[model samples]
Target chain A: MRDGKDDAAPRARRRFLKLAGLGTAASGAALLAGSGAAKAAAPAATEAAKGYRVTDHVRRVYDLARF
Target chain B: MIAPEDQGRAYLYRLLARLLAAAPDAATLGLLRGLGGDGSPVGGDLQGLAGAAATAGPGALEREYHDLFIGVGRGELVPFGSWYLAGFLHEKPLAHLRRDLGTLGLGRTAGTKEPEDHVASLCEAMALLIEGKGDLGAQKAFFERHLEGWAPAFFADLERARAARFYAAVGRLGARLMTLERDGFAFVEGVAA
Candidate 1:
């Protein structure tokens, strides 16, 4: 797992994770990718707590989720 | 790597910045030199030291930056995702990450040429995700698959890199975050598994 290679305990574990819901096979992640620098950042200290603006891929995932 | 989904949180950025900047002696150790703070070993370490090579006095730090990050040849750690993950640099991880980005509705800025795997970029992404700046589930997935695996090792090297001084602290901070992320993810997995 740490080596990024597949082994027994971890590999099997990872496989199980995939079999479960966590092993989400990511599709094309390039859709909304943007330069993070220009994206307006919510002021660090602000109380409003604005979001960092997610990509459409995330929205898709959210749509898929039963949660 | 603290669950990239949570990276958008201000706490994450502050932790990262603190990791980058040696937690000034006071906050770190509790020994306040002028204030009589924690007084840990790191507390008094960097005080006598100079600035970061890239942005030192009279642009010394900038010079160091050229030396460290923007040298004509190559920089210290090669802060790219491909380099870190694939070892040879620009391998499947980068392609995978890019694909993930596309699906997520995120786009790379036209101006900055650095690949998506840059540490700053990763951290920025996480920070955005954390503040609910993006979809929590999507951000979490991005962070879990790509970063949680490799970043800790990268930060470990950064801390111990021969040229490390100021960035040594950055390394430590990163190392700590790595621990947090690893354990945190494991905990989450523990539940799902």
Candidate 2:
């Protein structure tokens, strides 16, 4: 009575939940670590709100442009 | 790994984009007025921003934005790369930019009427590229292809526009930032050579 298709859904769900839990734990630990984590995330959080990536190309561009 | 200075640079680009995207509301003006500055010319421009915000009479900022960027016919400034590069709006430059945007997996925000080559939009794109984990070579190529062609002249025009008051300060800030970027890029190119 075991179906691989049925098993796959639950397995994926379980894996997703596990990863979510790990992310929450990591953020909780980050909060406990200090203000540095929050400061570091500020720009990223703002960028995420705007809904796009400036990407690593900007860094390379900046590096290339440097005198 | 992202460098902290690069992060700051990206933030500045986004800030400039937003400021140029629309007329600042009272809340936005308040925020600008509260911003502290260093002793640089850019810093002085920020101080000028605060002064302009403080003096923004009712409907003045909106009228200014309209006159400068969105008049009944055409605004004082075109703010589009195509116009600057190919002597017209919606030309080959814009088509090339669209292709580049597609390659970069970027697109205009939904319902936006302006072309992809608007200066504000371009600044936002640059900021997104910097923040989004894109490769350095792509960034350089994009800048050389799109921005390096005409942005500095645009800012200089902005600095002298008769309609410019608050925007003159913005022009100054933009010019300073552009210079810094140009120098930085030139230095890197020199080193590579």
Q: What is the TM-score of each candidate against the true structure?
A: 0.54, 0.70
TM-score of chain A of 2: 0.24
DockQ of each: 0.03, 0.02
Give me the displacement of residue A11 in model 2, in angstroms: 47
Considering only chain B, report the TM-score of each candidate against the true chain B: 0.67, 0.90
User: Which structure among the candidates has the greatest lDDT?
Assistant: 2
Q: Candidate 1: lDDT of A41?
A: 33
Q: Give one digit per residue, the lDDT tens place, for model 2 in B1-193.
A: 4444444456556666766766676766766666544554445556666677677753798788778876655578767787789866667888889998888777655544456776767776776676663544456567778887898888888889989888887787677667766654542322121
**When superposed on Cα atoms, how far off is each prediction in RMSD?**
14.4, 15.4
**TM-scores of the first chain across all predictions?**
0.30, 0.24
iRMSD, all candidates: 17.6, 17.9
Note the Cα lDDT for every prediction shown. 0.43, 0.59
**What C-alpha lDDT, on a 0 to 100 scale, does residue B31 get in candidate 2?**
66
For candidate 1, lDDT tens digit of each residue in B1-193? 2322232133344334333322233222221112111232222222212123223342443344344543454556565556666665446887888787667545565443345665555665565555455443454476676777777887788778776665665566466555555544443333211
